[model samples]
Target: MTDQSTPLAPRQRISPVSRVAEIVTSSPVVLIASIILLVVVLTALFAPWLVPHDPVRLTPSVRLKPPSETYWLGTDAYGRDLFSRILMGGRVSLVVGVAAAIFAVFFGLILGLFAGYIRWIDAVLMRMVDGLMAIPSILLAIAIVSLWGATIWTVLIAITIPEVPRVVRLVRSLVLSAREEPYVEAAIAAGSSTALIMRRHLVPNTIAPLIIQGTYICASAILTEAILSFLGAGINPSTPSWGNIMAEGRIYFQINPGIVLWPGLVVSVAILSINLLGDAVRDALDPRMAKRGIER
Candidate 1:
């Protein structure tokens, strides 16, 4: 007979691989999305070596040629290999999306920490964030790109600027709640420096939410870059980004729909996978959702 007051042994923490395996096995959608995203990312990363023909090489003889054994996907207006171009284009899209998300989160975390922890700067910082948020993100990005010129870096900056405000707001809200907790108050009373308290006490509370937010931001950034490229406000047309591919093919859609369809399909799948992964992460992280046994 066990003593009534005796505490049970603590459960061991699950390994990250085990946790991921559990998530994948429990959800078929998550499994499929994860596989597709993994394949796309790997294909993009290895594209330079994997491509059979030069993505930008112009073979006028093969221009507008339908899918063949030589050109697996087909040829575009300039006879660039659609398959090679797509693989290379994905690298650009992934780079921009990932870099933009990282920058946005990094800058937003710093600003939000300052704004939420220091009351003196809270109103001022929030006002600036509000001003940025007031403008439409797409319009703001276009304006920035137009002024700066259409380069990969310029497009990344354009996408990142609009996204920072949202992240700042999210972090600020998280900090606001966390700072009021008893542990935070105890830290404050213990003569800890503002920076120390923020780093030790506040930052951890924001990590889970930030991870979930980052996935959405990455997806949005990818879509936004594609839109910008399509509108001639993004990467140089010479560069074979997914957006440029679709934009070039739009005029020839009636003749060769595959050019546009292929890139568009890839973009849709990438974004959908990212979003679905984000949802899975959210469900896994949220204690309330876990307690409720929510499955999606």
Candidate 2:
């Protein structure tokens, strides 16, 4: 008679979003990475509206002017608006980075799947990957750019060529492991085609590593593009790039250190953020590690 209608115990409520909140709150590196990425994205999205002056248009009299009311980030030697150009240049930086990563990963996955799945292709793929591993990526990129002529396409292709083999090796290793799983074996026993098993079982399982690698490749691509531009082997001098900005700044470091400061700072922050993002992804994707991290 005490509480026939009501339960003896009080019901406990749990929120689904609590887990997401816990993750964001506990992971300082991830939170910082997210913020850094957010800053870049916001800057890119508002570049056209945010810049006070035309990036490409020049004012001869105002060339090399210091930071002031007229130009927040100061003028380059060309008298073009520094703030505008930096923001606009981000578009190119991001484009080259992302495009190169995609190109490399696409080719990598195809090669990796064939290499991992087909016995005949395995030796050839491994040998090619090994050959690529012997050469430093920067040197390879430099050689390719030298031959293709210094243009955006050439730079992108150069970046792609070096990254593909590394990605293929990583993916091939993953696929080889995945092929041994019960689901894969079941598919094989059920008479599923190799292509179907790969598509349905192997590729999906390899997604996590692939995603982490893609981000790393993107960061690397940016660095590569910057190096190429700095050395006068990348995008046309007429165009603005983070690297070109820094390259030009090196000459004026004595007169106006701000030339090197702004672009260099941007590059460092960008690369750091990308690394942080990679760490976050690696942590998140590994369940055992995530749980251990959360506990710690």
Candidate 3:
């Protein structure tokens, strides 16, 4: 005596991507961070048009001038325009940060997927990651750069190495957990192959966390590049990097405080912008919070 009139499956829920967008739009912090990040990225991409002067030019006559009408944000010890250098330096920082994070993420994803998929290989790869992690990232980068010689490629490789392990750890764990789920079990029971399962199902689920990690890594990479430059291990002097500017300022810290103050200000703002973007992204990607539509 079954109810023959009605036999129905439950409705499919809203997709997470759509839900995430809706929730993100509701958040003012996310809105502001997104806007600021966009502005910063665009400024970096268009530095030549926006900046008022050549970043690396020297003018001993105008050296250490205070912020004024002609030389806005004043000039450095060599009289290069401070604002122009900051703008130009941002372009380099953005390129390094994004390029390193993306390279690390790509390398990690490939390694992580392999490790997560194959049992015996997982132990070996994770151990290697562990060995790399045991060393302080900054020290490891300096050692590699010293051996390879200081160049943009060397800097990119050095910055990316530490972050790869982090991404691998996150992705591998997520894949392992998802592999045991009921949907995965169902797929395994069906005619689907392992490659199909991983490609079709596993990678998509892990993307949310990967995005969050990428933002954090971008912040870390930028900070690391700045520190390396400060320590004389970064870009060539002619490049006019913020870190280089800071390094130059160190000598004039006592007499001309603007030297340190302006460079430090730009670095802080850049790092802060990245961190804020990360926070907003983390909130948006939080599965529990996203599902509930609760502001967390």
Candidate models: Cα lDDT each:
0.92, 0.83, 0.83
Candidate 1, residue 77: CA error in Å? 0.3
| Top candidate, metric TM-score | 1
Steric overlap count per candidate: 0, 0, 0
How far residue 88's Cα lies from its native spot in candidate 2, in Å, is 0.8
State the lDDT of candidate 3 residue by residue for 217-273, as single tens digits. Answer: 998888899898889888776787778888888897876777778878877777777
| Residue 156 alpha-carbon offset, candidate 2, angstroms | 1.2
166-213 per-residue lDDT for model 1 (tens digits): 999999999999999999999999999998999999999998889889
- Where does candidate 3 stray beyond 4 Å? 1-28, 189-191, 294-296
Candidate 2 Cα RMSD (Å) = 4.3
Better of 1 and 2 by lDDT: 1
Worst 10 residues of 1 by lDDT: 287-296
Residue pairs in clash, model 1: none
